[model samples]
Target: MITEARQPPGGGIGIAVRDLKVAYGGTRVLHGVSLDFAPGSFTALLGSSGCGKTTLLRALSGFVPVESGSILLGGEDIARLPPEKRGMAMVFQSYALWPHMSVHQNIGYGLKLRGASRAEIDAKVTSVLSILGLAGYESRKVTALSGGQRQRVALGRALAVDPPVLLLDEPLSNLDAKIRLAMRHELKSLHRRLGLTAIHVTHDQEEAMTMADEIVILDAGRVLQKGSPEEVYRAPNSPFVAAFLGADNVIAGEARLDGEALAIRLPNGGETRMPAARRVEGDCIIHFRANAVHFGAGSTRAGLRLAGRITQSSYPGGVYRYEVETPAGRFLVDDERRANPGEAIELLIPTEEMHVFPAGMPSA
Candidate 1:
């Protein structure tokens, strides 16, 4: 819990991070990172470990000092403000709850430190507990609660302060798979109901895609792209962004303008033609998700098709995934029907489903 800054009714103010840079031991971690978080919108900072996502979150929370940057909140610069004065609350990866304290006491700890009256603290804590569905657990020790209940206590504590902005550092990563999925819905609902601006940091792609209104994909301290989950996933600006967004199947080839279509000629002498937003030529890479690749030939053939033999197959519930070896290379394909290993199969990828990027260009 941080400052008690009131937001406008229905939503909090937006955050504008400009040219933010940070370093530890004279080695730069974040090199000129910038982003805008819409008011009341959920934005996820997504990237692999050591990509400076955590550093950026900590910098926004006033815990990590920036080398050169400005964090604008409500038209005011908070880059140099103390953590307790930033008008924001952060829920950490660990619940960070006091084991010895009761749920109510833990939720009221920040208020107590601020010299809030007992009556005010109790009221705020009680209200937050009810909102988090832990109304009756207030009197129980935090250690006695389940993992999900303890997480709610952490969230309740952060909400008790009524900060305009909430920062979550993989808050649900500590939960089991099932519990984590449940908490995702809970957090999304809570954010909407409270109308607070939220910035969530996570390495999980599904977490970001499911929870965020907008996703910022970062790598090596630089932002690769920032857009709605659909936009980034469907139309990545580069090979790196495409690959990072779960388009793991890639094929490198020569691309050229063939009439009104962008034609890609694979090394196997096959060509795939797709609609192009702009004219592009020369070497390029085609990226698509494993699920985008279909099995077998049909009346409606795909633009990119390859003949291959299944090297491995596994039934993962709804769909059977097959590792097919083709002229290009091995690729994983998801299909409804089961195909045995060593069986011949034709893999199909629709043109629109493939992400095409010029070779060696990592950005748009």
Candidate 2:
């Protein structure tokens, strides 16, 4: 028996972090990271492991001490506040539920901690379980629930308190693929329905791209790029960002400006020209996705063409993936037409799909 959908405070409150820094003993994990979380917006902090994404989230939640800078929420600085006072609730990756506790007690634990009356706790727990589609399982112990159900209980616990902000630390990482996908949609729908400000930290690129309104790329404890998912994926600012976002095919070549395009000379005596919008001269590296490459020289589009031989081939489901040994380098290309190894072939890569950055740039 659910009454009405619960709304977060003020329909979600914005958060601002300014030059935040955090360290573990003598080692620094976050280096002056600054970000803004728009009210009712979902942002995903994306990075590789040990990139400090979790550290940043914990700092904002007051679980980690900030060495410098401030965390502002609703125009008030809450950097010094404890976790409970920050007006946020966190759902951990481990589904931090008590195995011995029933779903009802687990969901109402936060309310009880805040000194809420028994009747009030019961009402809130009932509403949460119903909203989470667990109405009849309140008396079931967490040990008897499936992973997905346990996760729902964890989310229920967080939502029961009605915090203005919701923080997720890879909460979907442990579930099976099917359940994880379903949970992604569920979380997104829930966030929209409740208009809650959410900050999710995950290393999965596809998960971030599909769920987040904004994606923040982090590396070595620093913010590398922040933009809409399409913006960052389509126009990465650096080679590291490009490679990290799935544009893994890389080529090294020399470039020189030629009118409106830059003529590139590959190591294997091949040549290509791409539009020049920036002052790029000398050694450079090019990046594109495996799917961006087209087989054969039949394409009439203007692009880079290279003659190569297929060194390896594999069937990774619907398409055949080939490793092409070009004069520039060994490149991965995905195509429907099957080809045997040692067979000569040509590759056509559209100019628009090429991401060129100066050589010696960071690849991580």
Candidate 3:
């Protein structure tokens, strides 16, 4: 479990969701989920389909009615408030821009609907256009803009309202790969400049890792883990989160306390000791990233060296991925050097790179 971080200077009040539960008719989508969004901090809600990430975001935005629990904004319960009444703005995945409206009109739509003076609406739109690098695009129809520009427009519209909290529901999923990567930095910069609380929902693990200050992993309507990206990646509490975060290499064995160290006994009569201090005993499973497995030419301390034969190989841009058969099991490895099938190879993995959990233990 991860604790809430400190608020940045000039940031808004923090948000707390206590035992939040939501449902759609007969079926519950969120089950007693709780979290705290630190003021001016960015949090990513990550999970697979039907994992209740979107449902949780919707509940936070007041778009979905809560079956139970309390949503406290600045220590005041806002669970019963309407979406518009809450001090929050949402940017949808579809860009949600009106094709017929010009960039300025679309950005200022909320202000107009709220009966702001024309001068005030125009002033806010102009400022947001410049902030989003759309100074000269105000008169252009949103349909004529590129995907990235449309994304900026949607973000600008959300910012024009000047809400305390920003809710993003897969806002970059529709953009091209290059644009999506670029927008990640842009969003981070915007969040810093505005000092607003942000909750982003994304199924893409890399996206969540790249943009979030904290990550919350959910599965089957329950939160499996919550922590900083590196913390969650390096010390995942369960097998599901380990695999979900790209640590796909799993090896099972029995572990026992060996004085100050944890030693694992493999089924094939091989043994290795981990540098961990925990005195865990019994059946255990080790999880590690594919790239964490180093082959030959690397110096890693307290590492396991395995002899294997390459069964398959493929060049995947920056790295060459290989499928190797070893005494432990078959697993994928990413290396900079190329090795052909049927070739003998050696691999090493540092003990600190492996995450160990008790087998058959359900996620917390």
Q: How many residue pairs collide in each prediction? A: 0, 0, 0
Model 1, 1-364: lDDT tens per residue? 2122332334667999999999988989999998998889999999999999999999999898889989999879999999989988899888899998999899998899889999999888877776777766778999898888888898988888877899999999989999899899889877877788999999999999999999999999999899999999888877778888888788888899888889888988777778885567899888888888887576286568888999999988899888999998898888988779999988888887888877877632
Worst 10-residue lDDT window, candidate 1: 1-10
Ranking by lDDT: 2, 1, 3
- Structure candidate 2, residue pairs in collision: none
lDDT assessment of candidate 2: 0.89
Stretch of 10 with least lDDT, candidate 3 = 1-10
Best by TM-score: 2
Per-residue accuracy of model 3 over 1-364 as CA lDDT, tens digit each: 0112232334656899999999999799999999999998899999999999999999988999999999999999999899888978899999889988999899999899889999999888877887777777889999999988998999989888877899999999999998888889888877877788999999999999999999999999999999999998888878899889888787788898878788887776656788764556899887788788868655546666778899999987999999989988887888888889999988766788777777886532
What lDDT does model 3 reach? 0.86
Please name the candidate that would achieve the greatest lDDT relative to the true structure: 2
TM-score of each: 0.93, 0.94, 0.91
What overall lDDT goes with each candidate model? 0.86, 0.89, 0.86
| lDDT of model 2, residue 261 | 89
**Residue 358's lDDT in candidate 1:** 77
Off by over 4 Å in 2: 1-10, 258-260
